[model samples]
Target: MDMDNFREMFLTEAAEHLQLMVDLLVQLDSDPQDQDGIDALFRGAHSIKGMAASMEYPETARLAHHLEDHLADCRQLGQISGVEIDWLLEAVDLLELLLGDIRNGRPERNVDSFIAGISKQPEAAVDCVAETKTVELTACGRGQLIQLQLQESVAIPGPRFLVLLKKLADLGTILESTPSTEDLLQGDAPNQLLVRL
Candidate 1:
């Protein structure tokens, strides 16, 4: 592998993802319940992880993976407070710094502090029993829920899923989505995504 070539491509892509992560973090800070924002944030971290690993940057990959895990936990618990958002933003900053070092031919920085900081935080217990819910719709709103299952073989489902969401939104107002737009954006959709419009 021509690492020089890969590094250039990685820098470009990683920079974009890092910027998106920061923007999503700011949005999440404003609305901690923003499932879409959380999903987008998670995707950014995930992309970084994948790219870093492919480029043989284990330290970068490890940190990105840890960040992705934290975001996943936040999504499951639905309890991302302002403090957590700030911590996430700081983590992003550290990632950006690490990427900068890589770009400048410096050695990978140690991310142990970041790992320790997040690990020290208390884990929120998820209410698995509360997952079930019922919704009552008016007579006029019947037939509004649409469930979509993406092809399992789709190379990258996130962008494709966004296209589907936009098409659905064009038809009518989206009342709800099962995996949520955020999850789709983050490429976390397992197989099916339900949309209510």
Candidate 2:
């Protein structure tokens, strides 16, 4: 395969695996005792690491490998706390950002801080508190809802969608999004994506 073709393939598959990892992490956050979720999360991280290494994205691969090892340790211990889940989610966000950089032809950014933060092992007891806090929306406090139509011929739309999602999240709390983050990460490539602030 052409190098361009290889890069495209890697981006497409990496996006799917990253999304799967995020979804599994979210599930694990809610139910830390779910062994299936833990196993799936480990596999997803491991897959991403392998793919990144094959693509010669050493930084991305190293980050993924660190996460894979962390998850494997969690699986062996049979517990993960809410704070740890938050850290993992943050790591996923960083991974998505790094992938976006590669897609945009930008140099890979250093992930040392993030890697160092999550590298530490957590205590044996798991905290079951929710990482995401529920907010009550008032009638007059509703934020704007925006709909975006991406070009149908766009290459690797999944990571692009995630970049947009992260940008939106930075501005304000996202109430909801269509084709949802989970759907987008799971390889859903609908032309239209709706977001509520």
Candidate 3:
């Protein structure tokens, strides 16, 4: 396949496999010793490996294969933990980096050093995209947003929130409040206080 066609194909497959792995990892986080979760992760890693290799990206394939191996070992040992999850996340990150290299016209890289550094760190804090976006103020969801920056120590945020809440209660019917009107009045929220009508 030509470079453009090959890249598109690889990206689609990689995204699918990555999503599968991410879902499995989230499940594993909830239940560390889930057999199915482990299997799912292994399958995802394996698929990524095959796809990468076929796309002529040896570095990507190798890294995925290594991750698959580690997961296989975990299966044999019958345990997986936070640290292992961290290691896997690091491996995934390395694979992403290699993929980026390939996409950018640079040669794909062997990220063994990046993989090795995971062990030294001990805990891998994976960066996950936010699950739900803060909804925009829709037609029915009309309410004033009270945002307060702590840079200026004007007054207690609670009092400020209460003043805002009172102002909001006057505008229209207060359909739903996130932290409850009472709680907000008690100075519970911070930085941003949103009221959705």
Candidate 4:
């Protein structure tokens, strides 16, 4: 297919993902313990990010990346707060606007300011996970399981996780991960990383 065909497909799928995220976010607002719903939201964002990156839509990809990271945090908390839900809804609305621009053949909007605002917001503490480290040496399985905890002092754990993954790749092949490689690359700054290698 041609570039235009690809763009149309991306736009259609992205819109569907956005709709799913919004519905799930609303459901989360009512019942915060909806783990499946939250996972769906994360998947929606991740799908959008991957598609946007493939389409070379940096702004859309960047916004989707931030949204995915935010969803990851919510997933770790096992609940979503009213305030966080509000922020997510607003972000989704902005994403809709961005999609509208793309559909209309307009310039992509600058989402950096919006992304910067997310960092300014107070972050949830994952102190419980930070204090624990686990490792399992599996002689029969595919590889050993290792869990690494990040200090609260680390400003950006996502890039650090990526670096660690790269370093570990040099030693041996990585078998599996909890959040997955794409999540880390999309900047999901988790307090701990679980990898089997």
Candidate 5:
């Protein structure tokens, strides 16, 4: 198989492994002492790590490694907490985002915050969802008003909107935005976004 074929295979397998991890995490949440579930979770992360490394996706591999290491620690402890499971589930969400980036042939989203949060205690894991980005404001003046509408098939719109804003900010200053940057960071999924650039 060619590289594109390999990439397609990798994307399919990685998505399956991620879904399995989510299911396992849900099970673990109910029965934290389920040794079998813990082992499966660890294996899932390890599998993604190895596959991503082979595919030369460094960000995906690194994120998977962090998850694998965390699961290994949980295995050593012989039990996982609900808080830890919730954190892992969030990590899985981020992994899915990374997978989407890979599938789209786009650069990987920033994973540093997620990695840093995982490195800390479970209570701190939620910090990764809170981005520290600030919208740049320029002198008040008339600017090009651009409106964007995400496709109906888009599963997640908040991140895509933020990406659009970031790219627009690079081209020119943003005067205003519907839903606001704060709303987007807080997980608002508006179908349409208006920006004055």
Candidate 6:
């Protein structure tokens, strides 16, 4: 099932979504009534949570879920307080830390303590609209950047991979690319391929 591939993809997407959450939260704090910003926040959080859960990254999933519900409350109540924004921003930062732990093979890192603390509050438990949402963030999306540090042993030829980038490009637009294959093809990037798709 390519679990390692899934883990890598999930980590990459989660990191981007977490950053989006922070940016959207900051925007929401300033206006406090931007429905579009709120919706974006919900989408980013829900997307990351779903991906994390599928990859068995429960800690990341739970944090995303927590952030989703918190934002949902603001949507329903029509206002967001300074304290609420602070908590939301802080939660995303913690999510970033936990995501680093997960990518490092340390999934046992204790994060439930922080999650449980947030889960105890009533406002954080606001009910979300029931819908069968399936639009998940992929390894490519705006503001969802990834630093691909390929292993040294990976072969350096188009044949090294069985031609997958064509399929990826078919799914979405390649927004930006660096360390061109010309560089990697000629061994100029030293396998430290950096891309933002």
Summed backbone clashes in each candidate are: 0, 0, 0, 0, 0, 0
By lDDT, the best candidate is 5
Score candidate 5 by TM-score against the native.
Answer: 0.63
Per-model CA lDDT versus the true structure: 0.71, 0.73, 0.64, 0.76, 0.78, 0.59
Model 1 lDDT per residue over 164-194, tens place:
5665677788888877878765656355566
Best-to-worst order by lDDT is 5, 4, 2, 1, 3, 6
**Which sections of candidate 4 miss by over 4 Å?**
122-197
Encode model 3's per-residue lDDT on 16-135: one tens digit a residue. Answer: 777567556645755788998898898889999999888888888888887888889888877788657645654665666676687788998767776676447454232221122245
Mark the 10 consecutive residues where model 2 has the least summed lDDT: 124-133
Clashing pairs in 2: none
TM-scores, in order shown?
Answer: 0.60, 0.63, 0.58, 0.60, 0.63, 0.57
Query: For residues 151-183, what per-residue lDDT tens digits would candidate 2 score against the true structure?
Result: 433334554455566656878998888879988
The C-alpha RMSD in Å for every predicted model, in order, reads 14.0, 9.0, 13.6, 16.6, 11.6, 16.8
| lDDT of the structure predicted as candidate 6 | 0.59
TM-score of 1: 0.60
> What TM-score does prediction 3 earn?
0.58
Candidate 6, after superposition: displacement of residue 65 in Å?
A: 1.5
Model 2, total clashes: 0
Give the winner by TM-score.
Answer: 5
Q: What is the per-residue lDDT of model 4 for residues 1-197, given as tens digits with 9 covering 90 to 100?
A: 89889989999999888767765765665588899999999999999999999988899999999999998998999888755765676577678778888889999989988898886653532322355454667666767787878765444455445555655677889988877879975657787888888
Which 10 successive residues of model 6 have the least lDDT summed?
125-134
The full ranking of all candidates by TM-score, starting with the best, is 5, 2, 4, 1, 3, 6
Estimate candidate 2's alpha-carbon lDDT, on a 0 to 1 scale: 0.73
